[model samples]
Target: MPKRDWITRLSTKFRQCQQSPFWHGAVALLLFYLPQTAGADLIAEGRAIVAEHCTRCHVVPEINPKGGIESTPSFKGMKHLADWRRRFEVFFTLPPHPALVTVVGISEERDKSRPAFVQEIKLSVDDLDRILAYVDTVKN
Candidate 1:
């Protein structure tokens, strides 16, 4: 608890850390850098997926100018909604969407009631996460 005791303890711990085979400095660097790197990767992958799949029906900024379908909303516009993330999470599981993409045992059942242009596209949960990550970067 004394000043001298605290200093001695700190120095001893530093020495132990330096002597160990484990590189604490490298671990610290990784801890600091990996998340941002992973996030950037996710955003990039998400952007690619959106460009490939959603651009057909939705307006994607920096990728597409006009919405593929007049009725469907633009990705840039959706980013402004308060519940965007939740809406996106379930967007593919809802009514008109049940006709699109089969996932996790969910089968694609094309809705004859909907337009013929609504095509089924398979997407995994990981894909959804990546898409959301990219969507998060969109400005309001």
Candidate 2:
């Protein structure tokens, strides 16, 4: 609540860390190493998500070997495009995607009767970021 209380809590934590030293290492590991894992975890999550959902119509060579409809471009090829980043960023709003993809909190739910579409993927903003982060690694 107050500045004094905050300092007191911090000092208490410092004392606790001093007493165990394990806390010091734990904090260091989290501060230094966890950040690297964050990007890796995001990419892993994106890979899994794409494998589960995107592989339906899109070819994601980073995660899948052989799949995707011929009409759709492979992520590998698309990565070299000038607007690839922008394309993935707002992909949920584009063309056939609108019928099959839904970005949580971003895109509205579509009617089930979207004609030829059978399934729609629901993705969060975080998922989109994850996908972008993974896509960023593509060789283009």
Candidate 3:
């Protein structure tokens, strides 16, 4: 069958299932459509933010970092989620970066060696929380 037809058939089946009052049907629907992790939404949003904002300067995340920020740490080899979680928690406790002193401005100190002078993207406390959760999921 064509892709559209297949989708239509599936939708019809889903509607029929929704009309059923069976506990098993409800359970099956819940499992089929609901996010497995409560944190899944935050993880996805975090991943997108990292990709869009950081990929040009930072290495696309991987198990190895052949060449990326030579001075700064890369997420490549960071295998310990617990450690990352702790580190991120520490980061939150500290004041935001000096460059970020003015809402989300960059430091005047430009380092060509690093991803220099990139303005801090303003993130809500909740956004930071979600980003950390996502990073924990992806780290090594």
Candidate 4:
């Protein structure tokens, strides 16, 4: 069949299904379940991103050995803080972060307690979103 005819047939079938009670229930179930699946996938992606970037300095769930420095808080621990979500939202723009990336280089007045060997790390907004989603799953 021609492409146009194939699409028209499919559309007609879909419209027919839309009028059926069975299809309505199926649609409702799909609508209810899809977001949960998407959320799970997003959390999984976030975990992977944390493992790739933050694991060097922060312990992340399910990544083994409880990595990161002793002084630096684990991802699970940080999640327990009331303001952690807000802090994480702006984490990349925070002080010492820009310096860590050599955006301006560390100033003498900067916090002296930070690890000297901490490397510059950069993440896309999507990556940050995923990491936050994963962090949300971490229990206190």
lDDT (Cα, tens digit) per residue for candidate 2, span 1-140: 56798899999988887889787788898999888899899988888888898888888876675889988899998988999999999888889788777787888766655643766578889999998888888786
Instruction: Give the alpha carbon lDDT tens digit for every residue of 1-140 in model 3.
Output: 46798899999999988777896778888887686555688788877765655444445464224645665456554444447667654453334343332222222443456542456555455666676766777646
Please give the distance, in angstroms, between residue 74's alpha carbon in candidate 1 and its true position after superposition. 0.6
Q: Candidate 3 overall Cα lDDT vs. reference? A: 0.57
Per-model TM values vs. the true structure: 0.72, 0.73, 0.52, 0.69
Q: lDDT scores for all predictions? A: 0.81, 0.83, 0.57, 0.73
Off by over 4 Å in 2: 1-30, 112-116
Local error of candidate 1 at 40, Å? Answer: 1.3
Q: What is the lDDT of residue 97 in candidate 2?
A: 84
Determine the C-alpha RMSD for candidate 1 after optimal superposition of all C-alphas.
7.8
In the range 35-94, model 4's lDDT, one tens digit per residue, is 999999999998887777777767766684556778777777877889989987766667
Task: Please name the candidate that would achieve the greatest TM-score relative to the true structure.
Answer: 2
lDDT of 1 by residue, 25-119 (tens): 78888999999999999999999988988888889878888557889888888988889999888887766666665555444554567633456
lDDT-better candidate, 3 vs 4:
4
Task: In model 1, state the lDDT of residue 8.
Answer: 91
Cand. 4 TM to true fold: 0.69
